[model samples]
Every structure is written in structure tokens, then in C-alpha cells.
Target: MKGSALTFVLGAQEKTCYYIFADKPNSNVGYYFAVQSGGSFDIDYTIKAPDGSIIVNEAKQRQGDWVFIAEKVGEYEFCFANGMSTFAEKVVDFEIKLDDDFKAELPKAPDQPIAVEGMQHSVDRIEAKLNDLIKSLQYYKTRNNRNQSTVKSTERRIFQFSLFDVLLMAGMAGLQIAVVQLFFKDSRKQLV
Candidate 1:
């Protein structure tokens, strides 16, 4: 199994593409992406096979996980587009995995006992579970990043709104005071 993971900032109205070569046919290709911040946490993505055929197309997606078999041996294109966002840039996290359909066998020792074989099997199972746990941790980390971004955005908006509200209230109070003073001045002039 071969894989690459990346985190990049996609500028507004820009598109970026990456190529992954599949040396073996019928290999399992996995793609995963998440929008960590900016512009509703969404992006457009496309996966094209080496033959220029679109395997997956998505628009304004926040996150996605896709696994497909590569029937041809060639380069696959993965693209992320932020064209929908006119001004907001986006932070994206993505992973690509190429796994061949071959399981490695542990070399057997001539003097190896049955217990050692069982122990190897148990070790393989443990390794598989550990991989799963790692994947889960990565997913949670992504979610945490996105959630933190959302929280900061909301906090900024609230602060700005509160400031505006305070300014408006102050203006209204001053206007009321001026009106009351003018009313009293006009009444005194009439009495005189």
C-alpha cells in the first residue's frame, strides 16, 4: 500500500490538480478530502481516470471519502476547485491511497511451530485494528479543525454585531436628548 496526505490552501477562484500513478491494474484507489476552513467549508472536486473519464464529480462538498478499483494502469487526476468562492480562500486536507490486491505472506521457518503461526495471525489482526484506530483519529482531528474554524467565525460575527448594536443605541440616545432639549427651548421662547 502506498499513500500520500496533504494539506493546502486553495485560493479563491482557483483550481488545483494532482496526479497519482497507478502501476498495477485492478488496484484499490482511495481518495478522501475535507474542507478545514473558509467559505462555508465547501469545495468542488473531480476525479478522472487516466482515460480522461470522470470517475467522481462533486460540487460544494465539505468532505468525501471514495474508494474505487483502477482497471487501467496509468495516472489518475484529482482536482479541487474553489471557483464558486469569489473572495474566500479555503484550507483543504486530502489523502490518496493506492493499494495493490496482494497480501504479503510471512516467511515460514522450517522449525517454526504452530504456536508461532498463530502468534503471527494475532499480530496481523492487531495491526489491522491499529490502522483503523489511526484512521478514526485522523477523521476526528479534521472535524475538530472545522469546528474550531466555525466557532471563531461565529465569535467574530457576534462581536461585530454587538459593537454595531452599541453604536446604534448610543446614537438613538443622543438624538432623543437633542429632541427633548429643542422642545424645551421652543416652549420657553413661546412663554417669553
Candidate 2:
């Protein structure tokens, strides 16, 4: 549940709107939009995530100058252009709606969009694996106090020092780095 959504609106009136980031921990998602002057109006504009930063940034324009996406979790920056060299467009409105993935507090969308059936399959896998993981952890936690030291010592060699731990750490770090890089490189190409 990346809980990330991007939405925005157009306005002629000079104004701003603040959008809240999703609740997911460390998820990098945002909204970006722009407004142009003159009749060259575009309402369905998108916000781009800034390169090498979690915050979104302003973009180039063809019609006139306008706003940027709300990059931060709190106050998102915005601007308005009426195309005319006059007072700020008095009759303009902004409509920005962000996704509410924060509600689930889960990881971003899983590998392959999990359909309803896929979710059931994932739940089943977790149920099977979680029980084993919990039981193994519990056994080790109590073995030191309830059983002989020899058994505990052997458990450490098999479970704690197993190839699984080393490989898992390497994989986790590799994944984290990959995700971080995915956002920083060539972001505008995707947003534009």
C-alpha cells in the first residue's frame, strides 16, 4: 500500500493548497501541477517529484507561469496565473486530492498488482510463514532459560549464523538502495 496518489486542479486566482503525505513509512510519492496564463488553460496538470529529493518542484510552462506540487508532507507550494496583466484572477479555484494509502500502513504495491485472489494467496503464505517464524523465535528465546546450554548453542549456530541471515541482509540493503535510486534518477522524464 504505497498509499500514494497524485491529483490537482487549475486556477486563475493566486492561491495555494496544502496536501498531506501518505501514512506509509518512508514512501516516496507526491503530486505536482501547474497553471498557465491566457486562454492556454490546462486543468489536469500533474506534480512532479523533485530529483534527488522527496519534495516536488516546479516545472516549465508553455502558456503562462503557475504553481508547483505540494512537495512536503504539510504545506505544498502553489501559484496562479490569469494570463492577463491585471489583478489576480478573482474567480479561480484549486482542487487537489491525494491518495489515502496511508490508511493501510502497508508496504507499497507488491510485485505484480495483487488481485483479490493474489491477496488471498499472499495471506496464506504469510500465515504459514509467520507461524513458523514466530515459533522458531519463541523456541530460541526460551531455550536458554528452559533447556540445556548445549541446545541453545546449537540453535544459534543453525539459525542465527545460517546462510539465510547473511543473504537476507544483503537482499534487503540492495532493495532499499534500488528503491531510493528509482526516485532520484530521471524523474522528470516520467512526470512530464
Candidate 3:
């Protein structure tokens, strides 16, 4: 199994597309993506097979994980669209994986005894478990990033609101003082 992972910023109203080559037919292809920050943490995505057939299409998705068998040997297209956002950009993380099911036989010396098949099975099992662990870790990382962004955004909004409230109160107090002073001045002149 081989894979590539990437993080990118997607601008508002922008569409980005990528391609991955499938060298062998019936290969297992995996696609995963998460929106780490910005806007509503959502985007549209589409996956097209080598023959231009749509394998997956979703709108306003925060994250996705998909696996499918590639039946044709060619380039597969993956696209992310942020047209729903008019001003805010988004941070996204994605991974593309290609897993070849064919296992190559290891060359062994004739004089040496053949390795036990059970040992090989154990190694394979361990590898699979490790892969699952990696995937779980990635998911947790994405969630953490998103939560941090949300916290920062909320903090900023709270500060702005507080500042505005203070300013408004100060302005009202100044206005009231001016009105009282003006009333006293008019009364003094009328008394004279």
C-alpha cells in the first residue's frame, strides 16, 4: 500500500482538482479529506474514474472517506469545490492511497527450511493493524485542528462584542452629560 497526504488552502469560490494514476486494474483506491478550518468547514467534492464516470459526488461535506476498486488503468480525477463560500477560505487535508493486492513471493535459499506460513500471516495482520492505527490518529488530528480554529474564532468575536459594548456605553454617557450641561446653561441665561 502506498499513499500521499497533503494540506491546502482553498480560496472562496474556487475549485481545485487533482489526478492520480492507476497503474493496474482492480487496484484498491482510497480517498479521504477533512476541512480543518474556515467558513462552515464544508466543501463540495467529486471523484471521477478513469473512464470519466462519477464514482462519488457530494456537496457541503465537512469530511469524507471512500474506497473503491479501480477497474481501468488510467488517471483518476479528484476535485474540491468551494463555490458556496463567497469570502472565506478553507483549510483542508486530504490523502490518496493505492493498495495493490498482489503479494510477491520472497526468494528463499533451497538449503534453508521454508518459513512457516503462520509467521507470514502474523506479519500481515500486524501491518493491517498498524495501518488502522495511523488512520485513527489522522482523524483525531483533524478534529483537534477544527476545534482549535473554532475556539479562536469564538474568542475573537467575544472580544469584539465586548469592545463595542464598552464604546457604546461611553458614548451614551458623554451624550447625557452634554445634554445636562446645555440645560443648565439655558436656565442660567433665562434667569439673568
State TM-scores per candidate. Answer: 0.90, 0.26, 0.86
lDDT of model number 1: 0.91
For every candidate, C-alpha RMSD to the true structure in Å: 1.8, 30.3, 2.8
Q: Candidate 3, residues 1-192: lDDT per residue as tens digits?
A: 778899999999999998899999999999889998889899999999988999989999999888999889999999999999999999999999988786654455556535645556677888889978977987898899888988999999999999999999999999999999999999999999
Q: Write down the lDDT of every candidate, Cα atoms only.
A: 0.91, 0.42, 0.90
Best candidate, TM-score: 1
lDDT of 2 by residue, 90-150 (tens): 2222334344333322344655555655766777788669956944554454333334445
Q: Give lDDT: candidate 3, residue 189.
A: 100
Clash count list over all predictions: 0, 8, 0
- State model 3's lDDT: 0.90
What ranges in model 1 sit over 4 Å off? Answer: 110-113
Q: Please provide, for model 1 over 13-78, each residue's C-alpha lDDT reduced to its tens digit, 9 standing for 90 to 100.
A: 999999899999999998888888888889999999999999999999998887899989999999
- Give the lowest summed-lDDT range of ten residues in model 3: 104-113
